[model samples]
Target: MNLILKLIAGIVAGILVGLYVPLTGVELLYTVKEIIGQLLTFTIPLIILFFIASGIAGLPKGSNHLLGKTVGFAYGSTIIAGTLAFMLVSAIIPLFDGGLTFNAEVATPLSNLINLKIPPLMDVMTALASAFIFGIGISQLQLETLKKVSDQGRDIIDALLAKVIIPALPFYIAGVFAEMTVAGTVFETLQTFGVVLVAALVMHWLWLSVLYISTGVLLKRNPIELIKNMLPAYFTALGTMSSAATIPISLRASKANDVQEDVANFSVPLCATIHLSGSTITIVTCAMAVMFLSPSMDVPSLVDMLPFIMMLGVVMIAAPGAPGGAVMSALGLLTSMLGFNDSAVALMIALYLAQDSFGTACNVTGDGVIALWVDRFSKKAGS
Candidate 1:
């Protein structure tokens, strides 16, 4: 009921903004929206840090096998789902006939820095090293009482995201939309490549369905039952478009799929923090499209950038944890690695935000599926 009201509020607010903004000529509205977005970007990192630290602290000590299986399944399944989705979308893009041409005018410039040429191998190593250091630090902080306090902190943060951050999303989205609409950014690009947009969205749905079905089959569970169990989480993610916001529902679905409580607690939060199948897929697909559309753009070859792409996908898991942080992170990668200008980043943002809900839904569903497989493997191994 609360979720429904939130959705309704977002839609109503969006409609109101859509209606009144043009008439009011509110020049400051976009500026205000950007400010709110910037605030979110700032908040997301703390949210991620606290959530991860607390979740790691709370994990049961004796559940290494369960944790291992769950983490492996989640990472493996995310890669599979992302690859399949990419393939499906790649195939479908040809059918769109959307007359989409990439315009370099949409590219954004990397701010005030000489392009530093970092080797892709070193870049990937740096990311892994950072993750390892964070993991080791969390592992060392294993005091039970501290864990409890951290868990409580996480709960409070979750409440804030749900009650406050989420409620503000629609307004932010509206502001983004209004700004884009006014700037002629929303419709102009999409109008030419509307088919590509639709194709990408459809591919998201198809891959999500495939992931759910695959989870059922792998776990020897009923597909319909799995879907039924996960529907609440799916809808929650769809509405919130934030996996962190949907964590509570995802934990519920994890349990419903027979994942042990200890394992579910550890894995679900970790997955929410790092397992960004939907976002990764969207970034790659969109980047590919941008490359294809802009023939003159000297984009890095896929073979040359594959390592970076994978690393970017992993780093992006840290993105949603910070408010509005993903864009900056993506821009960093695009400008530094892919040579994308600000216009390209803006267009990518437009494409990504327009279909973020579907991507989010996919991410949530993939998390649940991986949880189920992990639970089944744990049980079998114990037997």
Candidate 2:
């Protein structure tokens, strides 16, 4: 069966067990779940650092202008997505003023499992700064050995994704839902999450349409036909829910859309790492909806939130392409920077995971648009 199906089955089974399984006090499932969660978190910081650096180093030494344009445009698209989510969710939320409050109990023995953290020398923001310098610095200095090391680090991350992380995701998902069901918060909170999910999906479509319309005007191709070519990537991401996993497919789709080989290779993987428009939109929307509904929380004023939204846009660029990677990376910011209580953070996790596949579909699809844009711009610059 498909990986997505397996994951969905895990979710379904976990919810059922949580809701009906007579294993309420069972420590086995909870223990396993916490262990898996810790493992995934363990890989995130290093993976982000290495992946960003490797993607930077992957660009041709002579292609500094292309690199700048690619990064600039990718960051621009993400900003559009984050802002769009904020707008759409804010406008639509008054129509349904419903809220969710979660006072759920974490499963015991497993809840006792310690979070094994190996923090980076600096936090996420600092790590990205360091990565940018080292990644770009190595390329300019012609340090082939360090470049080789970055490539190896990227490979190790790839192995972790395929052999370890992806394989374990279903069980991890099951444990999450099961715990929620046991706590009796699943049904009510999911209702609020549903509203956030719909808003995020609509914003995703809007951003993709904007991307394709711009492509049509600049690149002089039928936007519909271009969108059609990208559908395969979108669908692949829908199933895998991992842009990193879908990179190979996304690259193939971009090539078929007539993106030049050099542009496709550098932009697809780099965009997969950096282009998290859909995920950011979904997170922002979900976080907002949850905040609106919770009595103890109020969605911060826009002026207060503007800096956060901007920082969040960049911070999420480091989000790995794993299933719950964006939220996992954003956890610290959500709690510390945004003042989300434990309950709010828990709600964010559920909401983010619920709609992650659609966000990923939007993300990989947008990569095609970015690739098309970069190709047109690079040609003009060269001319």
Candidate 3:
């Protein structure tokens, strides 16, 4: 919540500076944005490699079937949520406005004082592939040494995100808006930001309804009661803005929803890592909005968007615990798959961070749904 407030302050400060301050001042902000942007690019692949490798390799052994079921369920939910968001946002955004075009005549060009370049050790796809290979090998072969290494790498990256990147985001975002304000397009962009945020929030609840109702019908349980039991976890996530941090409440809530104690213990923690349907929805929605608002990009067709959605589900498995981690994790996909430029990516970060807590709340609440399903499936198999 403090993070959200700080981000709001950043946006307001940037807009004020752009409107009133000298070009030199706004250039300073732009320089900060450039430096932060380059740093983000450098760390994205490392975040993907270490977090995904650690997540996969650290899966509890001796529960192979349960592990498979949990992962399958989590991935499926994420993909479906992302695809659904694309469909809904695509259909709706076009009805309101075709696109938001920047006024080149009114736009003021800003330059960074320092052009620093920091390259990543590997590209996003290579990191993903390497992580999967090493992760599966470590898990299947019981390689404790490599597993420890991956875990340590994950810790290092996690600290980098939590301490450095997350703290710097507000200034990074301020720089983005400051540039937009100078370009005279900030107000138009702000209008679209509000609409897209509302749309994303509505879709979050809508997807939650779909998940719990479907789970209830399949298991012959009261969906409302189950959802009611999960409300504490939902509210907790809104405060923590992290699924992992909300796991304790989620565990109690899942048990209240009648998920077996053992299953809740296993699935809640695992789902915190892998089940990110809510984050996927926000990312997909925000990505589409950024495309519509950017002249350099176009809103993708269903065929084009499907591949991104699929990749998004996989990439989300690597999202760190930092605020706005989902957007950070998906940055590689946005750039490589969707061709998001720096300005577009900056808009995505701003839009996503605005409603990060709501999305996280949905993520943790939906974990209970997964817990219930896994419990039922495991019970039937045992019987």
Best prediction by lDDT:
3
Alpha-carbon shift of residue 94 in model 1 (angstroms): 4.4
Clash count of each predicted structure:
16, 0, 0
* Worst window of 10 by summed lDDT in candidate 2: 103-112
Candidate 2, lDDT over the whole model? 0.74
Q: Write the per-residue lDDT of candidate 1 for residues 1-383, one digit (tens) a residue.
A: 34435433543454455456653443344444555555444444444454546544544567678767766666666566556655665565556434666664522111222232323323423443544455446567655665566567657766666567656655655554454444444454445456556767776677777877776687677888878888899899877877889999999988987778876787787677667777667776777677666655754554665665665655554453423334434545665567775346545655666567777777787788777667677678872
Model 2 spans > 4 angstroms off:
1-3, 13-28, 99-122, 214-222, 236-270, 312-332, 339-354
Model 2, span 1-383: residue lDDT tens: 25556666766777787866666443456556767766655565666677668767766566677778778888888877777677777777767764444433343323534454543444555556767888888878878899999888878876787688767767776777677777766677556655667777888898889889888877789999999988999999988888989999999999999988998988898788878888888888887787666666667767766677776766665565557777766765675567775445555766677778998899899989889889888888872
Q: Which candidate's TM-score is highest?
A: 3
**What lDDT tens digits, residue by residue, belong to model 3 across residues 1-383?**
88888899899999999999999999999899889999999999999999899888888988877888898898989988998999998888777765554321235599879989999899999999999999999988999999999999999998998898889989998988898898888888787888889999999999999999998898899988999999999999989999999999999999988788888889899999899999999999988877765666667899989999999899898999888998899999999998887878888888899999999999998889889888999998992
Candidate 2 colliding pairs: none
TM-score of each: 0.66, 0.78, 0.96
The Cα local distance difference test for each model comes to: 0.60, 0.74, 0.89
117, model 2: CA deviation in Å? Answer: 7.6
How much does each candidate deviate from the true structure in C-alpha RMSD? Answer: 7.2, 4.1, 1.8
Which segments of model 1 are wrong by more than 4 Å?
1-62, 94-98, 106-131, 134-188, 298-302, 322-328
